[model samples]
Target: MKERETWKNGKEFLFSCIGVSVGLGNIWRFPYICYRNGGGAFLVPYFLFLAMVGIPQLLLQFSYPQYSSSGPAKAWVCCPLFKGIGYAMILTNSAVAIYYNVIIAWTLYYLVNCFTLHLPWSSCDNIWNTENCYSRTYGLASMTGNTSSYNTSIPEDQNLKTNVTLSSNDSKTATEEFWTYNVLQLTDGIETMGTLRWQLLLCNFSVCVIVFLCVFKGIKLSGKIMYVAATVPYLFLTILLVRGLTLDGALMGLRYYFIPRWAELLRPSVWFDAASQVMYSLGFGTADHIILASHNKFHHNMYRDAMIVPVVDAFTSLFSGCVIFVTLGYMSSTFQLDIDKVVTDGPGIAFMVFPEALSTLPFSQIWSTLFFLTLLMVGLDSRIVQVQVLTGSLGDLCPGLFRSRVSWTSAGVCLVAFVLGVPFVYQGGMYVLQLVDWYIASVAFLLIVLLESSVLAWLYGSHRLSEDIAVMIGYPIPKFWQVFWRFITPCCILVVWVMGLVKHKPVTFGGQAYPAWSVGVGWIISLVPLMPLIGNIILTLLKHEGNTMQRLQKSIKPLPEWTKNLRSDQNSEQNGDILL
Candidate 1:
């Protein structure tokens, strides 16, 4: 077999992992989840779950690739029956990648418009605006201290101190109209996939080209790019936070973000949301981190990398909350609305609320450009890593076909992913995006994480994994990690998954639930990725020449080659030839 490529140093691997961890979700998803769960009170469960669930699973994922010197799929030599765990990882990440770039395309379209003297979404006079459209900027400029005509019963004694007038019940802000009409060109339902939006198609194609160029040369070039792509978003966040703090109601938003609702800690859903957020923001149970660590030098300190990456991810999510809520707080104070009134869920916070907030700022065009640029960079960082995961996995699985042609592998994956993503740029694409994201990214992802934890900690053996980590890092894992890996993490994941399933509602957009047919399609999208696990089990049982129980026991045993490289390293360590 040809030698697998390794990173020049551990720093490259760390940065690559961090780039994937601190993705667009930290900016858009985490803040809203944080605020909704408990305002400031949510941190209790968030950090609790992070410690109990996130770090342990991260170590498990990190350890396998580092020890095996292979991608997620190929690393499963430890327990070949569970190799399907790796397949599930790849499929889930691939499903995410398909629709994710369309978001980057949306950001690209917005970034281009940011260069204009006047922002397109600033007024109601745009061609996309309807008779019900009311300009948020116009309202902001026209009514300073004037009381809003919109009916509200909240007393003036409240914390926000609402005094300004708001648009009526029927009014949609220019920001809203632009997002729904101009950018998305949204149809009423998923059944009506209208004509392609040529502008967005071109933008999505550009995203594909950019991703291809960055990754086609392999990790050396991409690793160098991470030096910038991984860290620059921090600079943008700091800038936005500083600017947001200066606004009148910025403190109000900050309070909403950090102030703990102690009572919320009693809610099962609050804890579940926190656990799920840790999984989402930290990029757990994904192939990208495995591929990233697989490139590290054999003796590199992944225990440290695992620790630092999750910390940075959590900090970025917290910092982004400051940036988002302060702007939200300002919007509330400006429009004399409560914080809850101003806040929105899902992508609305990114494409609508934040854009409207930026429009209210002085030098709105400059700020808008910076914000979308941040989104573009963060989204691109994640996209490159996802491509790396797919390409690297294919190379690992079929070295002969891809061994000398890594670039070709990358190009083909990017081309195929881009083509699949094209449907998202259609007029009704947002609906399809919502449907796929709801099913493919949610429950299926939880199941993948649960399966990995069980197989690695139980089936493959936690004590063995700890010994493997000690081999690479020069020390054994703490008892806490071992205990959590074998028991606590799995229990927490099961509770969260079950609770989420019980509370689950049909996926909806703009207050409208998807049709029954579309819901079925969503289920199929989620279920197809999980088929490998069942199929592999039946195959393993049939292939082994033994009784059912004996076959099951034999299937879980490590292959002879599983620790071949590790034994060589152990011998070298005993000879004092290998040093950590």
Candidate 2:
């Protein structure tokens, strides 16, 4: 048998974790979540959840891979029956990688356009623009109708008097038209898988190539690349922040972002949003962290690594939120619209609203290029980790097939992921992306975390896990963490899971409801990860040679390969000396 690979050093592992955790979710999703939940008031529950749930859960996940020296698929050696959790992680991450790359492709497309002296989205003259397209503008002219300079030939449906009365809401901004018409070429709804856009396909292909090159040599090359990928966003964010704050209405946006609405803290939905955001932002319940941490040396001080990474993630989110809302404030002031009018979530903010905001700045083309490049880096960094999780899990499972040709295995994984992502490049791809993001990414993640916390806390025993961590970190386990891992964290997760179930609504995009069958498909995507657990249970029951109870008990016992040291450590602890 061959030996498993380990990260070159502690710094490499830390950078890998940061690369995965601080992703598009932090930049695109966090700001909108904050805006919707309660502006600044949401931070109360968000930080609370971060302390009670996020940090503890991060520690648990980090411990598993570092201790076992195995990827998610092989990390669950402690309870072999729950090996399905590992498989679920792999499958969920694979599904995420598919649609996630499409977003990166979109960013890449925008990045390529930034090279032109005039941004394509800055004008309404393109074939994709409609008569209703108007550049984002300022002064009384934008509020009143002085759009004759924007629209060359007004439609005959409206006379000159009617045209003079038009408002900012009457027509789509150039950025909106560019996103809906030119970039996405979005179809009406999820039911229609319209013709594939060749440009997007090429862009998606290019993104796949970038991901492959980054990881083809495994952690050696990827760790070096992560040094740049993980650090560049902060530089871009700082530049954007400085520029955004200098714009008019910047203070108004900052007030909206930071001034707490204390009443929002009393709402159950706000707490739920806070919990979900922490999970998503930290990459919890996903295989990315587990697989990346699996490469750490046996005694790597992941306790410190876990602490540092989540803090960095939270800071990045707060920083990104400030940059986004400040720009939105500038946009709102420029267009004579409310700040809320310009603020949106997910791809809406990243692709449309922020681009519109960028157009109002001096050196608009340069700013536009920098903004999309930052996005491209953010998305690319996350995609690399997801791809690593998939390929790492496969390599761990079939060492003989992959250990000799790590680069080839990585290429194969990227190829398969690229093919899977093709559907998302179609006109209806955004709808599909929304569906996957909702069902697979959101619900499946909650379910996995609930199961993982329950198993580790109750069945595997939190005290034992804590002692193991203490040995590795050379410090006693904190009492607060013990309480969190054993009781508080799981209780909080259950509450969030129950709330998600109770508040569940049918998947929709831009107010368009999905057809029944399409909703069914979403459910199927959500359930696919759970199938491995069910299949594993039935196989164990059928194959084991013993009474039902005995066979089941035997199946759940720790595997001999990775758990020998763990068992020995436990035994030595009973003898008053724990082994690292």
Candidate 3:
């Protein structure tokens, strides 16, 4: 028996994986990185990384979990020696999901408020007129429930730069162009409204309820929901793209987005950024994707769909960048601000800059409604996937605890997740967004990709892996994947990882301090997968009689499915029983 699926079937599985993979990262990170890295120049390393590291690592992530019928922790049981790495992924999945879902809830909050035609942060004294709240006044509240002065700094033009007068006898001025500058409302950093703690709590709770409703059934239900949720955002985004591009400043935005700096295309850091984006956006090396996809039927061509997901994701990202830059150009021209101030990406881009832009548009209320509603719907799938990964991990690891005997196991998990989310419902939930994102989504993910690729490509023998892929595909994989997986791909990931280490610095922001313990914790967090690798090497090198080392050192046998078809052909002269 296949046992209870605890989720959906093939198509639903694919949709769910796509749903998680195509979330906020595509809309928020892709375009900005593309803009800053090298515009069209960014595409080169992106495609290369997708083919080599991105797609291959994705394949590995799905294949292991699906075959093992395990969650993050048990998926690598064949290498139980490194199961801690899987545990790390589980911890990340849970921690990130809690905070990430809070952000989704914030989107829902904004979407709901848009129906009120509220321009709560319009910075205009005339705001709250509802008819022209663009002209209204608003107040800021701090976390301790204190009020702060508010300003209506609606920019008159979006593409202006700040200048400092030279303190010289002749009163001459000199400008040094820094990379942080952008095209609109061109301030360097925009902090969240720290005084809005109550609003933040309301927003976080609102989205949490929606996510709870969507995910209560896991992937099967969420998959069908995502068919709409995942597709709707693109429709709205496309509308924005077409409308924004047709607007007077669209070309200016396009020029800003794609005008490649040849020198920038050569930077090693650019490739690293592009690689990281692909990893995150494609759900490469993510246990979350595997758990969702484990529900795919044995016969599904998920590998082909896997290829399609990244390509489709990349297209959406580029499309969004064009749209974002166009609107940014308009904002810049309107407010006399530079693009850099207006073009921040990731969480801040979605939560703040885009909302600020919407506050400036004609029929701003309607546009705000469309924009946030689309994001709410689009992001729901992602939040659901994260929750499902959590439940799936818990369910698989202790089946009786969450399975038939424990009817409320699912509810227990949802409660735990909700509880985990409470601390983040602060005034600066967006700051919580960035902090959790860095901790749960960044360095840990990179370590897994590097470790998994090294094991699969170099240690496991890619030639045999290619043969298995050919068998499943019913056609030989293109020579490109074979060579890419074996050498080019793994090498690229290693280079990126090493370079990141070289470039890494202790993180600090806004003159706030992180303790020495916090810094040590961060380093410990980064070396998560490698910590076990030391033991694996020791096990392999030690020689002893009847030792766990010998048993642990043995390479995994190929699954029965891999060899059965070959034996089926030779059965005329051979024993079928042995094969069975």
Q: Of the candidates shown, which would achieve the greatest TM-score relative to the real structure?
A: 1
TM-score of 3: 0.79
The 0-to-1 C-alpha lDDT of every candidate, in the order given, reads 0.83, 0.82, 0.61
Q: Candidate 2, residue 449: CA error in Å?
A: 1.1
Q: 1-580, model 3: which lDDT tens digit per residue?
A: 1243634446676666667777777778888888889888888988888877777777766655554456675565545445556666666666667777676766766676677655554442221111111221132211221111111222322212222211223221000011111101122222332233455566666666777677676555677887787778888887877767666666887898999777787788898998878877876555778777556544355578768777777887887787788888877776667777678766667766676766767777877777777677767778777777767777777766664432255566657766777656543343344445555444666777666666665555577666655544456666666677777777887787777777866544434544566566656655563555555445534533355645545523333443433454356337644311
Residue 240 Cα positional deviation in candidate 1, in Å, after optimal superposition: 1.3
Model 2: how far residue 228 lies from native, Å: 1.0
Instruction: Kindly report the root-mean-square deviation of model 2 from the true structure over all alpha carbons.
Output: 5.2
lDDT of 1 by residue, 1-580 (tens): 5567888778888888889988888989888888888877888888888888888888888898888888987888888888888888898889999999899999999999998888888876655555556775455233332133211322332212122223566567888878876788676578777778899999999999999999988998999999999989889888988998999999888888888788888988888889889988777666888889888777899999888888888898899889999999999999888888878776788899999999978899989988998999999999999999898898888988885688899999999998999889988899899999888865778888888899899988898899989888887878778899999999999898888788888889878989999998988998878888778778877889878889988888888767766887878879989544
Better of 1 and 3 by TM-score: 1
> Compared with the true structure, what per-residue lDDT tens digits does model 2 show for residues 1-580?
4567777778888988898888888888899989888888999899999999999999999987777878888888877778888888888888888988888999999988888877887777665555556775521222332344323443433222223433456677778778977787666566666678899999999999999999998888999999999999899999999999899989999888888888888888899999989988888767888988888766679999889988899999999999998998888888889887888888899999998788766799888888888898888888999888877887888988886578998899999998999989987788888988888854667888888887887777788788778767778778678788889999998898888888989899888799999899999998899999778778867777889888878877767776654565577779998432
Per-prediction CA RMSD (Å): 7.0, 5.2, 8.3
My TM-score estimates for the predictions, one after another, are 0.93, 0.91, 0.79
Regions of model 3 farther than 4 Å from truth: 6-9, 126-196, 405-407, 428-433, 441-443, 510-517, 524-549, 555-580
lDDT of 1 at 135: 71
What is candidate 2's CA lDDT for residue 230?
93
Ten-residue stretch with the least lDDT total in model 2: 138-147
